[model samples]
Target: MRRRKRRFLFSTVCTLFILLAGLAGAALFFRIQGKIGASRKTPDALFLEYVECLSKADYTDMYRMLDEQSHLNISEEDFITRHKNIYEGIEASGITAQIGQVAEKDGEAVVSYNMSLGSIAGEINFSNQVKFRKEKKKGYQMVWDDSVIFPELGRSDKVRVSTDKAKRGSVFDRNGLLLAGKGTASSVGLVPGKMSEDSAGDLETLGNLLGISADAIGKKLSAKWVKEDSFVPLKTIKKVDELNLNSMEPREDNVKNKEFQDELLAVPGVLITDTEVRYYPLGESGAHLVGYVQNVTAEDLEKHSGEDYLSDSVIGRSGMEALFEKELKGTNGRTITITDSYGTVKKTLAAKPRVDGKDITLTIDSTLQDEIYQTFKEDKSCTVAMNPYTGEVLALVSTPSYDDNDFILGMSEEKWASLNDDERKPMFNRFRQRFAPGSSFKPITGAIGLSTGAIDPNEDFGGEGLSWRKDESWGNYYVTTLHDYSPVILENAFIYSDNIYFAKAALKIGYDDFMSGLDKLGFNQEIPFDISVTKSQYSNTERIETEVQLADSGYGQGQMLVNPIHLASLYTMFANQGNVMKPYLQYKEEPKSEVWLPGACSSEIADRIQTALGKVISSEHGTGHAAYRNDIEFAGKTGTAEIKASKDDRTGTELGWFAVFTTDPNLETPILLVSMTEDVKDRGGSGYVVRKDKAILNSYISGGR
Candidate 1:
């Protein structure tokens, strides 16, 4: 009886402990639930959560937060479409939200909020109110509407950005021949949402037909989470005629479709759109001069943030196109509009018309340019021709060259790599490279000697020797070599290109006067022109410690460097009566013809030099006699500059050079030609350079076609 009573008492105490514990657990659970419920009902907290969903483009979450009335009014698809449209139009880079105040109206709670979206243009700010309704199970459901986007937006209105693409200006040669201009091309595109998993094989087939990787196609088609209406471009065919439907084949599993044309079109949402593309009509001939354009990058959009430039805008990459990019790129226009959910324009709010870019004309003659380009197609050489009197560039040629059309039409990776890695450097502009002038510089030496009264027109020097140097006091520091002509006079020295005579003439001209004369002739000075040219180089007499260096420089042997453009321009002094006209490319500017200081000699001295140079083509003994023609009376000089393989090496490469000019009395167009060639295989020496000059001059004389 005692044991039973003890057991009953123990059971009673245990029951009481269990009951107390259950009551405490119930109280704790209710306390936790109340905190969570209050937190969910907080207007600021709920509004902030909704704002975060919009910023991340979580349309599903945003739609779930809407009240029963909003869900009944707007479908999930339409809601997502509306959000995407606004996001894409603004191209928002970032977003920010702030809850300002909460108030009660008509027994309903409303929260005021400020939202800001960052874009390329700047920040867009909007102030609006979000209504909330309390309900069972759902703490605070949003009474969502279009007014949440902007206070001005109504039930039927939507925000949109309308872009008005501007027309890029055309590029033309001096003769108004179109080089680069706007044209249309066919573009292949894909819509991701329409491409079902079963139809994904179509992309691989289309990729094969387009000569592109299937993976690349897939990446472009599904670049990011996109709407069903989003169109993504796979490739653009600039030359539609080159597309071959017969070459494209479908998969074995797709028996109904025989070719890629039918196979790709059978895929839902596949499309072909006509797109504007930059065209190069002149092809590779004027490629370097005209350059090409490419689509703008993210960095470019950021750099031009203040302007109306978008990521789709085109920018110049090189050559003259890059040099004048601002003038070539027109001002883009914009239109802000209100649209319906289906993207149908309800009203055009405001718009600004685009301004077309200005057209630019160069001074290059197409006919002459084509001839020069073709002639140097196989040769590693450079040639520059200009109107000596007016300084108008007639032709500028550098080879081996790539077709500019290749860049405009879209170059292959293999082709671009090949061009960049070529040993001959086809893309390099050889015309602007600096090299030794050799015997072609003899005229400058003669002019300086004559102007400084160092050489008399009748004064005779012994050109009969193959070598020359100063007296023993100079310790035979150096001996300059030349072609020996027995008892050569100054005129014969000029005709025969006697190096010994010129070496002696430099001694008489004095080192100081010689250096001054070179400086006057525009050596080492910046040349003013549309294209940049390197300054001519010569050794400073102050830096020269030996008499041999002076003698070598006198005959264009030591430390002398010049470019074809400036060399041709330098010869203009002879044709223009001692006036060195400034080289120009634009036709609008008035001609700048004035004598360059220190280099321009007296009229009498110019006449004397002209008389001597004329013998170079007229006289039988002249070195440049090969350049003479029956219809063309011309004067010029020839040179073979020595290129040492090593600095200390005695002998190596021979760079041939020719500088010539002719006066057309009928048109007053004095033509000057300067050419330089690398070490050619079969053709060697100045004679080869002269032969090329003859061919080029003959074309000009025969009406320049």
Candidate 2:
């Protein structure tokens, strides 16, 4: 009984001691937790103090609060300079600071605050997160992990503002095939604050994967490094396609710092960003028509202050883009979000959606344009074809054109120089360039004579082979004869392209009547068309001292200027039965609507002109007989314009021209083709030899043959 009592008492005493010790330990633990909680709490007065310090330019205190990496990266002088540069007016006005809630987790604490600068107030809501750890003898110290700045005040009273992401628009061909659209391109960027001793090795490995030199990557890094923050992107690699990006593998060797490594693993600076670039699968073809976009300049910014609502990086330089910029350029969308100093996205503030541009259907036939371009590959020339009735441009071809893709992607200075240095002046639109009309003007003279009744169609005119006479006033001017002095009819004059015949006819017609014909055909007037227009000039001088000068004028030469488009439209009178249609390019949805009407001419005169032109092409002596083809019955004319060889000599270059109209008996549609060539000496009659090759015309006639 005594042994049992002793054992029980000892057990009870041991149990009591254990219970009391546990209770004391619990109280001590609770006390330590309370002290930690109190230390983590941020005082509202601290925010006001910070604002006062900043206003007084207290650099030491500001530097003390910054993270160690930020302190090491930026000097005191630089910190002040950056602050002054970015926020110049912040100091002069009284500021206010408002403290927000404080949050703590693990050994870290976060304090948020709002700051307003003067009357021009804005919000600065920063997330001041710090890590605390014990140091050797010093009890404990705090280290900042990250900081954030944000706009606290709204821009407008509209509280329902929702932010939107700007999705790039798409580009398509006439067939709706993708040309230029949004896609991901591989790039390289850096976070300077995160870079450490191991960063070089990491960068070297990344460079190898990217197929770039380490030095190149380093140079880029050095240029774009952010001193105060690690989240700002530093560099961007251009033109990296998807396949290459997909092959890239992230490894520890490619990202040194643990935090940066995690970031690289998730969202690598050598990341693929969704971007838009101009593309052309047809390569250099249709380059001139499509044109290109380039970086906007200061001058451009000023000129488009209010009008520009899209990208600041691009603008239409030429071609259709320049001609119809307003219709083609769409409004851009924007997104405003509250972000922490580390660029971590907070809540989205506001957004506006982009408006898409309207699609434009061009009148150009791609196949025909390509054919015409190929024809002039070995030669230098321009060709233009149009529907006379509607003035719908079918083809406009200029050889030696540069690819528009190069311009869009950013052309180098050397490439630009090479293109501009070509002697052929490929950049110049020959279709719009001026050239002497030569003998092509003869038909206009004929129209004038007929219109004024100055010369009857059956009147007999004498012709000479080469009429040249010395005149003191005009120098040794010379006139060539039409078909030898025979009683040739009006049709015969055009068939033989009789120079003397027209000269005599012009004399009877009088200058007033000739000028009237010029005005009637849109000469000396601005005509609206898709392709650029170069005004045609007619010489007003009546009499020539030398017979040769008169002969030249009679055959359509000596100071007469006409473009292919102008000359082509002149033949519309014949095709439309004497009603010359005013040429236009804008197509109307409803054909009967007079919104874009092309005025018509008298039908009686058109019939006469048609009859004369038909005889000129089909007749034995016709100059344009070579242009005849079996595919379609056509009326046409050929002209060889004589230009002076030099400033001092009578001999000059010859310009060959051909204007033809395919007449569909059904009258459903009439196609007109005008081709012009300059200085084809070996090829006679203005080098119409190449023009008559019929490749372009055959394609047009046979539907892409």
Candidate 3:
């Protein structure tokens, strides 16, 4: 009876103790849950604290709070370089943050804050999400996400940027024909970070479709690892026509599957951007003048930064495009919008509009330009045609030209090599380089003698062969064609290109007076034009002894150098009644803000020169009789300057030249033309050909064809 009683009492006590312990454990669990819930609700406070720490440059604390992946990917050095400058100002401004609200969705928390940094104040709404995962040894620790969202600041005085879209300007010729303008070009760009590694094969396949190599695709795919921003472009494949993209073949087996195709479509990296490209209609003909446009390079970006100017996109490389770059380049603008972490549009914060560039119309006549090109194409040469009355360039041609379209897109190594290797030097603008003016300068010298009253039109110096007493080694010791010959008049001297007659005239006029004539004729002065011009140089020495030296100078030789344009302008004085117009390229109706006035010479002197030049072509012994015709009374002079020939030596090659001016009393306009050629042999008169084709082309203009 006693044992039974003891067993029953012990069992009842044990059961009561067990029930009490179970109730206590449940209460402790409820308390812990309440603390966690309270902490989650205070996300706004946590975000503000975190921002405050960042404002103070407490990067260690910031790093500790970041999610595992972000922590591993970003280093302290990288973070500092990226945000140090921006955050330094924020920290120095004694900024404070105020939490607005906290919300939770899809296992993440978001908080909004009003931030003030110095006098510059703005609102910043951000998300603070904690990721919890169990560890092997310890309890769970919180990992904070780095992504942040900002509220719209609206229009502010702190920043003023353009928000308007840039409408590219049009490029037109002097005749208002379009040469190059903005056009739509198809392109494919890659954002390597947003692309999946498994998509590498698909990218290669796509590259092949776009006519790019597999290696290029792989390089683009690996480019993102070096970038701070995930959206930067790795590569852009251009000239993607409609046929290519529509015919894309799916090499990836998964891509062929409909479900997988839909997934691939959701990939974020592959994109098409609407951008402007320069297009040339004339292509090769005016390539040097209109030039070409291309993408901005690293060098360009570095050269033009932080200025209120156009972004580094297209630039004029040469010709008119290069000369008037400032006028042609317009201002570019940008528009920005605020968005949430999910890329949902929160609001449009600011906008700016872009301005279109001005259109430039040149003084170039397309027909004349074509003529010049055709003429020079027959032989390697250059030509420049201008309107004497206005100094407006009608045509400028350099043969063996290149197509600007090649530069517009991009030149391959081979094409560049070919251009660089050409012997004709097609890239060089010969119209701007100096060459021997030859006999073409004779009329100007004759004019100087007449203007200065050093010689009379009727008066003559004997035109017998020239002879020098001091220097006769080169056979310059010849006597007169006729002993005690009749006086050589100015007309006789000019028509025959008599070396002795002009030498006597130059000596009588004196070197000072002769050089003064050259100055009045615009020598050694910048040829007022849009394009560059080479200034001609003439040697004027006080002493003369050698017969060959006198002979050379009288016939437009002996260190006389003039550009093609210079010679044309010089001849224009006769045609335009001694009024020299300032050369211009940009035209009216699309006029530049500035205008150049004409340069005038002495009319009296000009008429005398015209008379002499006329007699040279019309007279029976005229040197340029080959250029005369029946339609109009054309006057000209031919020159053959000996190269590599000394004052004593008579042997060497000759540079042939011809300058002419034609007029009709019935017509209002007069035409002036100058042509020159180098390295001709095996013909009469210095064994050279004067490129008669140039005269043939000029005839068309004079004939109004």
The C-alpha local distance difference test score for the whole of candidate 1 amounts to: 0.75
- The lDDT of model 2 is 0.58
| Clashes found in each candidate (C-alpha, N, C closer than 3 A) | 2, 14, 10
Ranking the candidates on lDDT from highest down gives 1, 3, 2
- What candidate 2 gets wrong by more than 4 Å, as runs, is 1-218, 221-276, 280-285, 309-312, 335-351, 466-475, 481-486, 530-532, 540-554, 586-601, 645-651, 665-669, 687-693, 703-705
Q: How well is each residue in 83-181 modelled by candidate 3, as lDDT tens digits?
A: 454344222346477765655565555555566444112222332333443232222323433233123322121121224544556677667877677
Looking at model 1, the pairs that clash are 284-403, 284-404
Model 3 stretches astray by more than 4 angstroms: 1-168, 182-214, 217-284, 307-312, 336-338, 342-350, 466-487, 540-551, 589-601, 615-629, 645-652, 662-670, 683-705
Error of 3 at 639 (Å): 3.0
Q: Write the per-residue lDDT of candidate 1 for residues 1-705, one digit (tens) a residue.
A: 999999999999999999999999999999999887764677678888888888898989989988888999999999999888877676665778888999866546899988887653346676788899876667678898887877767787777776777788887777788767877666678876777676567777777766778788777766666567788887665434332423376324233322444555676667767787787765556666667888788998888776677777888887767877888888777766667778887655446678888888777777777777776677778888888777888777887888765665567788899999999889988877888888888888888998899998687675446665577776645455546665566677778887777777877888789888877888888776778878887774344445676777777877878877888877887777777767776654565554444248776777677778889877888889988766666778888777776445765777788888885535544578888888742475878878877886787676532
Error of 3 at 554 (Å): 3.8
Model 1, which residues run further than 4 Å from truth?
1-159, 183-211, 219-276, 303-307, 338-350, 472-482, 540-545, 589-599, 645-651, 703-705
TM-score of 2: 0.62
Prediction 1 TM-score vs. true: 0.69
Write candidate 2's Cα lDDT for 1-705 as tens digits. Answer: 999999999999999999999999999999988887644434343444545766776746755555455557667676666555334432224545666665556543445665544311223223332333333332233342223222342222111222232333444443354434343322345555555567777677766544457788677666644453544333332343334334566434223333443444443344433345655433345666656667678888788975633335466677665665676666555444444455555655434466665455566666666777777755566677767655566666666676666665456667788889998776777777667766666767777777677768887754455563334554745455534635666777777777767777766765555666666677776665665788876653532433444445556775567777777777666666555555554444443211121223356656665666666666666777766665567776677776775436655667777777776645444578777777765577643543454566665565422
